[model samples]
Target: MLATIQKQQNNYVVKFTRPLSHSVDAVWAVLTENGKLQQWMSNLEMIDLQKNGKMHFNMNDGTDAFEEITITDYVYREVLEFDWGKDSVRFELTTTSDGSLLVLQETISELTNHTPKDLAGWHICLELLCDLLNGIVHDEFPMEQWRKWFVEYELLVEDVKND
Candidate 1:
């Protein structure tokens, strides 16, 4: 589903809420464990799993380069927030009666032409994460799906901006 976007004070907040038929622990592992994390988000790796710890964004450009991301907040299986450029990304998990609910929020300092691109990328990553949790895997990114989402997000962003 498309995430809800809103202008929050000086910044814009994009929030995606996903209800998954998996336990909180299972979903948490995929978000935190390097092995499982690679299945969905290959570039991000949790080098230190604590508040103020670090995660690395691998360049993946054949140059073993990486950008260090600081863990702004961490609370075991419940919350994880980290720096994302001038903004920040946060993941929160909660147990449901049947499974779990995952909330991903990205706080954008400013919306630019590239904002929709980042939102679409994140939308695809969440879809991939859901597939992995459901025992399905993809060897490569579904670029076709991303292209479709990018257009949708572009429109969505414009609507939010007008509001």
Candidate 2:
């Protein structure tokens, strides 16, 4: 499903809810493990796994450069939130009777043209995570899925503009 995008005073909040047939621990690993993490979000590398920790974003373009972002409000298996430029991205997981519910929320300090793009990227990342958890591994980024979500998210953001 498309994420719920809404305006909140000075910030624009984007939320994606995913119901997965896996334990919270299993889903948390996908969000935290380096191997599974690279599969979904190759750009981020977790340097520490605690409150006031660090997550580095690699340029991966050349030159071997990276930007460090601080992690805060972290809980071992329940929450993980980190700085994203002037904003923040948070992941929250709750165990269900049969599996788990994963909520991804991005707090955008300002609504810009790039907001939709970031939303689409996060949607695709979660999809990749879903596929990986189900043993449907892809050796590369899921551009096809990303392109599909981008179009849908663009429409979502446009609706926000109209409303």
* TM-score of every candidate relative to the true structure: 0.99, 0.95
Q: List the global CA lDDT of all models.
A: 0.96, 0.89
Error of 1 at 104 (Å): 0.1
Candidate 2 residues 1-163, lDDT tens each?
Answer: 8899889988889999999999998999999988888887889888998999998999989878999999977998999999999999999999999899999999987767787788889988888889889988777887887888888988888888788
The sequence of per-residue lDDT tens digits that candidate 1 reaches over residues 60-147 is: 8999999999999999999999999999999999999989999999999998999999999999999999999989999999999999
Q: Give the worst 10-residue stretch by lDDT in candidate 2.
A: 108-117
lDDT of 1: 0.96
**What TM-score does candidate 2 reach?**
0.95
All candidates: CA RMSD (Å)? 0.6, 1.1
After superposition of all CA atoms, the RMSD between model 2 and the true structure is 1.1
Q: Which candidate is the best by lDDT?
A: 1
Best by TM-score: 1
lDDT of 2 at 44: 86
Model 2 regions more than 4 Å off: none
